[model samples]
Each structure stands twice: as C-alpha cells, then as structure tokens.
Target: MQYKLPVSVLVVIYTLDFEVLLLERADHPGSWQSVTGSQDEGESLRETAVREVFEETGLDANHYGLVDWQVQNIYEIYAKWQHRYAPGTRHNTEHVFGLELPCVLPVQLSPREHLSYKWLPWQEAAGLVFSPSNREAILQLPAREKARG
Candidate 1:
C-alpha cells in the first residue's frame, strides 16, 4: 500500500564536540536541515531514522551515537510542501533523534534531495535551519546531552 501516514523522523546529526551537520535542500537551495524523511510501512521511528541518515548522508547510524530524544513534534504542514503528501493532509508527526559522531565526517548526499552539506556549531546550525521545530531540536541538543550524562 502507498504509505500515507505523515509520520517521519528527524535526525540531528552532530559530533561529540557539538558540531551539527546541515544539508541544503535540493528543491529549495538555501533551505538547510538535518536528516529527515517519511517513514515507510512497518518501520519503527528508530529504524526510519537510521535508514534516512544513510540514505541522505551515507552515515551509518549504528557506528555513531544514535539517540532518540523521545521527543515528538506535531506541526501544520507548510502550504508549499503539502503537495508531497496526500490530499487534505494538514499535519505531520516528527520523531526527533540525535546522531553524534566523533567529528565532521564525509557525506554522500542524495543529489536529488540535497544540494550540499555543512558542519557548524550548534547555535549556527539551529539558526540556519528553516523549520522552527528543527531549530528547536538543535537548540535542545546541549541540554539533552547534559541530561544524558
């Protein structure tokens, strides 16, 4: 069946030192964000996160520190992006995750989905992302890390 659930995962790819990785959206050149994608049928949120990270950035989620913040955000779908979903879909559920690597690692971007990638400090990454929820997730990283510690 064509999966129509607006559920998805957002992985904030960062380093142990808090350098976050952001990717430019191919469809919207200046728009940048962490690894994100819709979930497929029968896939758990964590599984979706791992698959999307590899699909979008070639990073093995298992090799790094992959943590599910256990945070979920439900937001109204942007008018411009609503076309990608089924008709009358007004909202989406996003599960937030954090993938911490040792350092800025090489990326293999899906050219059709992203134009480029950048590694930046947490503050800068938070500011650069277009989505408010994504920015909020980035901003929460430090506190999340600290709490985990």
Candidate 2:
C-alpha cells in the first residue's frame, strides 16, 4: 500500500472573537476539528494550508489572515488510523497554522470527509475535538494570537 506523506497541516479556523469553525468527520461522527489534511507532493506547507482550507471549508485563505505558528508536532499514529500509512509507519509530523477572520464565515463542507459544521467558542471547540493534539492546538489559539500582536 502507498504510504501517506509524513507531513500534514492543521489549520485553526477562528474569528476575532474566538469563535472557531469545526467540522465533524464523516468517518467518525463526533470527531470535530479545524481544517486539516496531508500535504500533496510538491506542495509547500503554506500551499497545503491554503488548499486544505479551501477544499474542506470553501473559504479562501487569501481572504483571511493565515498565520503559520512555525510549530511542528510529532505524534504516534493511532492504531485505528495506521492503515492509511505505509507498513511500519507509526508517527506523523503535523504543522500548525491559523486562519483568522473577522467573524464566523459561511462554509461548504466536503461531503465525503465532513458531515456537518459548527462555530463554537474556543474553549468549547477545544473540548469537542477528538485528538489531544488538536485540542491542545485550540487551547493555544488565544496565546498564539496575542503573541502575534
């Protein structure tokens, strides 16, 4: 089986007021998260972020402030998800990004990957995400935004 690229992007889509946009995974109903996807071959991290945001939410990253946190996370691949990767692949490197808008924006969910979407406050959004790293990323948003000031 072909292995997935080790690099991926995690975009925290939020508004100035901290309302974050989350999509429920079609494969896992209760698993909600910001826009995320693996990087395509020949795509830069920035390109991956922009493409994922558009593909997953129908929002143009160019219309908002897309910030690269310059943070990378290496984590063990969940046993259930390991099949997506090559044999012996046990970890992935995730790069964090943020897309900040002035308010909650309309989104068009990719029907194949996401079943629904919601805009929730940062704290609540953090609690709803299934992945610990995803939750941690949401929790860091406020601090990350402040640091950008």
Candidate 3:
C-alpha cells in the first residue's frame, strides 16, 4: 500500500452568503470536516485542493473563485489516522484554501471517503468540524469575507 504524505490541503467550500459545505468522514463515522485530502507526490498545494474538492465533493474547484488563504496549520496527526502516513510521521502541514461558489450546489459524495454531506451557515459548520485546524479555518470565514468586501 502506498503510504500517504504528511502534507495536505483543507478546502473550505462556501457561498457568498456564508453557507459552508461540510462532509462527514466515512472512516471516522461522526467526524465532520471540510473537503480535505493528502497531497500527491508531484502536485502543488493548489492542485491538491482542487483535486480533493473534486474527489470529496463533486465541485469543480477552478470553475469558482478558488482562493489560497495563505494560511497553514501545522498540527499533530490524530492517532487514529497516523497509520496512513509513513512511520514516525507524527505531524502534518495543512494548507488552507477557500472556494466561493455562487450559491449552494448539489454535492456528490464519494461513498468511500464521506458518509454524507451538509450545507450549514458558516458559524454552525465551524462548530461541527472534528479537526481543530478545520474548525478554525471555518471560523475565520466571516472575518475573511468581511475583509474581502
């Protein structure tokens, strides 16, 4: 089996009105997170975000306004999921990005990766994610949106 990389991307999919799309992990049961995935060997971080969003949800990331937030979260990998990475890989560096859609769109979840999906107001979605980095990224959305406006 190909062990996963220690680098990943977190793509927060949302609309201009502040609704965020979250996905529940199939492997972790109740763990909900934004569209995320590990980086492939030769891909750029933005590529990872685009690919992950498409893989986890059905959205074509580039078709919308996909912005790299210029933020990185360096955190310890959760014990339960550490085996997916190389041995001794205790930490992961996650790059954050945001995909601003026109509005809520239909989502197609990959059954193996996600159990289900939901679109919630940014605040509620921030409260629902399992990862601290994921939650923090979601929580920052409102301020970022305000700054962009």
Model 3, span 91-117: residue lDDT tens: 999999999999999999999999999
Q: Model 2 misses residue 109 by how many Å? A: 0.5
Between prediction 2 and prediction 3, which has the larger TM-score?
3
* 10 residues in a row with least lDDT, candidate 3: 53-62
Q: What tens-digit string does per-residue lDDT give for candidate 2 at 1-149?
A: 56688789999999999999999999998889889888888999999999999999999998889989888999998898889888888889999998999998889999999999999999999999988888999999889878878
Q: List the residue pairs that clash in candidate 2.
A: none
Whole-model lDDT, model 1: 0.92
lDDT of candidate 2?
0.91
The sequence of per-residue lDDT tens digits that candidate 1 reaches over residues 10-126 is: 999998889999999999999999999999989989899999999999888988789888899999988887877888889999999989898889999999999999999999999
- TM-score of candidate 2 to 2 decimals: 0.96
Q: Give the clash count for model 3.
A: 0
Number of the candidate with higher lDDT, 2 or 3: 3
List candidate 2 segments past 4 Å from native. Answer: none
What are the models' TM-scores? 0.95, 0.96, 0.97
Best by TM-score: 3
Candidate 3 ranges beyond 4 A from true positions: none
C-alpha lDDT (0 to 100) for residue 66 of candidate 2: 96
C-alpha lDDT values of all predictions: 0.92, 0.91, 0.92
